[model samples]
Target: MNAADSSALVVFSGGQDSTTCLAWALSHYERVETIGFWYGQRHAVEMECREPIRQGVARLSPLWASRLGPDRVIPLDVLGEVSVSALTADLLVASSRTDGLPATFVPGRNLVFLTFAAIAAFQRGLKRVVTGVCETDFSGYPDCRDDTIKALQTALNLGLNSRLVLETPLMWIDKAETWTLAEALGGDGLVELIVHETHTCYNGDRRTWQEWGFGCGQCDACRLRSAGWQRYSQARSWRVWD
Candidate 1:
């Protein structure tokens, strides 16, 4: 990307991945804009998590706002239409991870979000877009794969005809690796920032860091976060001796 033309738009859910993506965005793009969604998720606090991210960006070294300017925090309130998530129901919320795709999967969610965000980026005269979706932690989400992203990128370019680059910074990184990358990119406190500050729980519980910023212990989000933090924390401790 030309330094003169490095403006970008990021799909930010204000969650652990997205917030780290935002910080990563600030490092590369000359200007960064954030696009958030409120797609009737079972837990509303996910949207509210955007606040600390906004604050974190403000506290960056060069200052995120100074680089990205003001971001567009879009709150898409299609509460009734987006009922595909397993997080929408009660009983299933406890036992819905056995299937191939998993019920917690939101139907066409990232698709819709990225499509809309692409339009937003185009409208703003920006050529680049960043998302934090990862195949490493997809569990079963088809949209998080690099193949899917690349295919979508091709179709989007054909339709838009203006060169829209969709980049997934976390495409190949697992949860522990993602934490490591965020730390490498944002310094030592990156993992803490994501675990304690950013929210990704489907149950919307901010009860403790043991869940590792994910919603509930039962959900996939919580499971991934739980395992990752455990491994990362222990590995960090061992590294202190090495």
Candidate 2:
């Protein structure tokens, strides 16, 4: 399928990476829609930021505004009900004893997300599904791995008997490169929108405003974002200096 003419559905979480992926989709595809999930996350505020981010992204370019389609929010509260993690519960964020993965790793979260995204894509006749799951500069979630996404993509296509394409624009890149990609896709405005509108705090603390964005600045998510922003900013500064 020609990506320039294809339609895509983005699995947006109103976070930095997903928002970047959304911009990437809008830049590449002819039509792009977004789908968010409410799994009773501790940082449910991310859902609230979805619409505003969509509007902000659309305002970036007339082409994007024209190509951007409707948004959908799926109620996957069952995942939260069935899983015990720092993201779903009030427990402190740490590593698990068995696998050393972060406590924020909601088991099977991405798997279920991709499955439902496929269903939504099938219903909407969207041939491509975009996600922001990354292995680099992430909290070590197994489902976010490239291998896992590829496997799930194969399973989804076989189970649905459809030619749905799973797209991960941020899979191999780190957070700094993610920022760079967003800038490349939409320029400084997009970066500013991501910093001001997107929510990535695992603690759901919208109170503290960091240079990277709004976050508690202490959680794993915040640290990754902050570090990435620092690297991204420093790199840009050095380029300007050169």
Candidate 3:
């Protein structure tokens, strides 16, 4: 790879998608670092799962493990004060906003995350930011769109007067495709590590373990993941994971 495709800093959340992206970066980049955000989300499983996930991946894929450097978690307590989404709210309603935005949509969450990640990457002399923002299998968050990421990338580069590559490995792919990518990257063991360890539930429920992970299995995030897992399993001629 050339200088343009060298090292990377992944905006990791210890969730399934982000974990896959981190692995993707590790496979492709010369070096990879991860940054997490503690923005006062109601479901803090993603934040809490980071260390164990790192350890689990290390055990599963040692080649990528050493590439995983110290992951930083930036605390942004003020973000909770300004947003009324299900992620930040004390009481979350299973509905949409008055203007039709998803109830789980935390306003400017990705933007803030990428901005901070960019700053950290800049400081570390890293010019690439890998994120797991998927437009195909998501909860309709506007910030997850490709154009939004491009715009932010441009603005960040112009503001800092530095060229930074914002990489989104899962941008156009759906859940099943994501699973396929994970299997491609590190086979079934890596996929199992992600399914059992990473948390993707909005309700923070991990009691019922499924093929896709532990969640209520009814929430938007759970449904998407479960559906994808089902599709991927069927494609492999394996019985559905119960």
| Residues 1-242, model 2: lDDT tens digits | 57543899999999999999999999989989999999999999999999999999999999999999999999999999998898999888755536787889898999999999999999988999999988888888889999998999899999999888899988889999999999999999999999999999999999898888899998888998989999999999998999
Location of the lowest summed lDDT over 10 successive residues in candidate 2? 93-102
Summarize candidate 1's per-residue lDDT along 49-115 as a digit string, tens digits. Answer: 7877677666756566588665666656663265556655453654545556777777677787888
| lDDT per model vs. reference | 0.76, 0.92, 0.87
Provide TM-scores for the models: 0.90, 0.97, 0.94
Ranking, lDDT, top scorer first? 2, 3, 1
**Model 1 TM-score on a 0 to 1 scale:** 0.90
Q: Write the per-residue lDDT of candidate 3 for residues 124-239, one digit (tens) a residue.
A: 88879999998888899999999999999999999999999999999999999999999999888889889888999888887888767899887788889999999988887754
Q: Give the C-alpha lDDT of model 3.
A: 0.87
Name the candidate, 2 or 3, with the larger TM-score value: 2
Span of 10 residues, lowest total lDDT, candidate 1:
89-98
